[model samples]
Target: LLSRLYRPLRVCGVVANDGQSGGGPFWVQAPDGVVVKQIVESAQVRMDSLVYRTIIDLEFLKHVDF
Candidate 1:
């Protein structure tokens, strides 16, 4: 199985949050169904929105995707 896997993968890095606000690595799905990594900041997301709230709740409620 390992031998059959030849696709390159990019790993995202994480660190301890120190109360600082800035962009962080995130996996964003494109219109064509391609998922790309990009830096996103808290300000860029609407914390009050239902979609964002559901995503956050789901992330903690279940096993996260790698």
Candidate 2:
């Protein structure tokens, strides 16, 4: 998965199956070797939504000089 993301230089969504019907975790490693993990438990609401949203908001603020 990390290889795929690196090749495309984009975010990828993943779903894991263990035959038990539950959401799994997603992970990404930065170019500087920082690791990030997101544990998702339900399809209704992602556990990483708040983190992703905050990152987006921060980027927006930087772009707008806010």
Candidate 3:
């Protein structure tokens, strides 16, 4: 039963934000200063906040290949 249910997963590409709803790949920095890839959710972040704008302007979020 487990064998029959087993399936491989593949990531084709990232889905960009449409300004409505959706989440995709993003680079986030940890409190320890270690940057890592995370699938950030739109609801988890406030898109219209000043901090968000500052992060974008500073290029804190980066694009990376998996």
The lowest-lDDT stretch of 10 consecutive residues in candidate 2 is: 57-66
TM-score to native of every candidate shown: 0.46, 0.23, 0.43
lDDT of each: 0.60, 0.49, 0.61
Please provide, for model 1 over 1-66, each residue's C-alpha lDDT reduced to its tens digit, 9 standing for 90 to 100. Answer: 464357776566555444466555567887877687665677777899998757644534233333
Candidate closest to the true structure, highest TM-score: 1
> Which candidate model has the greater lDDT, 2 or 3?
3
Q: By the TM-score metric, which is better: model 2 or model 3? A: 3
Model 3: which ten-residue window has the lowest total lDDT? 56-65
Report clash pairs, candidate 3: none
lDDT of 3 by residue, 1-66 (tens): 475349774555664434555555667888977785677666777869998756643432443346
Ranking by lDDT: 3, 1, 2
For residues 3-63, could you state the per-residue lDDT of candidate 2 as single tens digits? 6567644454654343465544545465878786654455634447897546433433232
Better candidate by TM-score, 1 or 3? 1
TM-score-sorted candidate list, best first: 1, 3, 2
Which residue pairs does candidate 1 place in steric collision?
none
Q: Count of backbone clashes for each model?
A: 0, 0, 0
lDDT of 3: 0.61
